[model samples]
Target: MSTGFDREQGEFARGARAAVVYPDLGGSSRDADARLEETAGLALAIGIQVEDRLAFRLRQPKPGTLIGSGQVETLAEAVRDQELQLVVFDASLSAVQQRNLEGALGCKVIDRTGLILEIFGERARTAEGRLQVELAHLDYQAGRLVRSWTHLERQRGGFGFLGGPGETQIEADRRLIRDRMARLRKDLEQVSRTRSLHRERRQRAPWPVIALVGYTNAGKSTLFNRLTGSDVMAENLLFATLDPTLRQIALPGIDKAILSDTVGFVSELPTQLVAAFKATLEEVITADLLIHVRDVSHPDSEAQRDDVEAVLADIGVAETTPRIEAWNKIDLLDEERRAALSAETAQRDGVMAVSAATGQGIEALRTMMAQRLTAGHRRFVVRLDPSDGAGAAWLHQHGEVLDHWVEDDAAFYEIRMAAQDHDRFLARQDR
Candidate 1:
């Protein structure tokens, strides 16, 4: 099967044998074994049958082919022996390196970026999601056009009706890609503007937004469903949820909140995707609270946490934003481990251990969310004419009304709310 289009079908079409290679460049922070395992999981998520997995310690990377000549020959032999249909590299590959490897291996080859793009292309459900994926795909392809099409080098003369010789096929194709990327960017900008307006409306309503973010398959979707009582696509596979999902829920002391389940983050996530999905991730940026879920049972949980934080920092999430760590999947751990983790969480300031599957520690989590939302909020006591039902209802909806009583034909309310909301209320009262 060809690499480009057929690779997109890897997740659904079965029986495609593949080999995975992870080049362990020195001085990397991530564990090579964990990286290899994650890469294998990524391949399996797309339905590729992994026949061989190899990790090479590379002292220096070859220019033409990423791997050395001996490694290439050995891999070639194994590919022929195993009759592998594809080879997937765990690192980004230059177009020339990709072409050279494909020539040597005599089979399809794809790198981490390409594999991720394929998964995104398949998983994106909404129109905006598809547009973003297509835009990223086009941008990635634009850089490799010359390497992809050999016939692009052939000269083409203009018709007699036209003035001069026409642009070469490669130039024409690149121009077309550029134009398409421009249009897609324009469309995405419009979508972003609409999302901003919605965010503004939410701000006026002033229900706190809580966004869930974590590594792929860390049970973010499961936790989201448990918290919101909604069935999102939560599975063991990587990237099961692509499009951001939002639902309204009631929190302790808080009347309502908008809970958002966002696309999972992965290590070395394609730059193209990061740029393309900025509009979608704005939900995370504007959230009053961020719930960072972690698979505590996983061996590389700490490393995964670092990766997620790096991505968040890269996306410009302010360091001052309030965030909580949800140590999910505690059920998978042994009793002693669970007890230790629970104790550790208790000692921590903003961490909670919970199993989304069994409703463990969920109440504590909710309480913590409520506390974080109301932290540093201002308390106000206001007296209103009993006949002014609108003002009473506004206070009830916009703030946490701690107590209310009727006295002297007036409604007296004791409320606690964010300073911003308090200001907004005062502004509205003035008008």
Candidate 2:
């Protein structure tokens, strides 16, 4: 969708002209500038034009406004000067703080969580993605529901919310929100079950699955398209690809592998979204291998990697899951720096420096993926009856046939396959 400007007129969209503010409490491992840059990127993702970006150093957060009144007045001056319609706070603002800040700043106020929910709300295209976003939004709004109605005293006579005999307007609204969220949860549960069934079927098959994971706008979709040759909305915007896309690709040694591109992670992603998107994230948790796509050109690439790791840990990715680094966007670097990195990474075991857009080092990356996925395969020997054409074909299709011979009117074959695949082959024989 076209954003931030009207098609008919060249006017800025309402609430699109804004400022991004970060409150530095001196607790975060990252400095203030990086946080502000990310927050501005979040704003720009949804077509918001950031007229001003500011970071304030606070000795302690105020209970009412999160920042000192002096700082609020200064921000208000900037807001009025810049003619901004919205103010985006980089920190999580409580309901009270948000209300007070709006009153003082003389403009609309949104915290980081609210802004992220807005991005997800707009970018979610699939039915399941919309459902998850709605659930997360409701979860966020439920806590901040205000009793601002002049007729809040009006209520029904019968029993209602909280098992009470009557319900206030706010309480009734909360009840409706809760009821909708409950229905969404049940629907999502069905989706999750279906996804689990699909994943189980893929596992029962011989093909391995690789999931691409990293921070938002880390060039994962580009890499996925480069690897699989499928166009799946690779854009420069954050959260460009909200829904997961899976495609079958052939590796050097493997006949087929399932490559999955998943939603990009962000720093301080809303907990509601994490809980809401559990079904979608199952792909990452269950993947046979994870390729972490990193934007090596970004100044905070290391910190971004840490944030991705934090989310992975929060989502319960197993320690046993094999992972490799794909240092992407090297083409953005100068020639000398890119060449040095390429030379440095070529000797590394689990790292590859490449540009997805330029197709540099892509073949080496493919080889590395195939080797990692097949590293744990076991060698096995099987004997089949002469009439068992299907069995022999299965062995050849699902495994690397090291040897084949005919002995005593039976077929003897030596192959390399994953343990689970071997078990499935044996199960077929028993059947």
Count of steric clashes across candidates, in order: 1, 0
Q: What's the lDDT for candidate 1? A: 0.83
Alpha carbon lDDT of each predicted model:
0.83, 0.83
Q: Please provide TM-scores, in order, for all candidate models, with all chains considered together.
A: 0.91, 0.89
- Model 2 TM-score, all chains together: 0.89
Model 2 Cα lDDT, one tens digit per residue, 42-134: 888866788988999999999999999899999999988887767889999998998788778776677898888878866787889988987
Candidate 1 lDDT score at position 153: 30
| lDDT (Cα, tens digit) per residue for candidate 1, span 1-431 | 22221332222133468889998888767778888889889888776789899888899999999899999998999899998878889999998998799889877788998888777876788989988887878777777753332122322211110111232323337887788789989999999999999999988777789999999999999999999999999999999999999999998878789999999999999999999999999999889899999999999899889999999998989988999999999999999999999889989999999999999999999999999988978899887788888888888877789899998887888999777777777787788
Give candidate 1's TM-score: 0.91
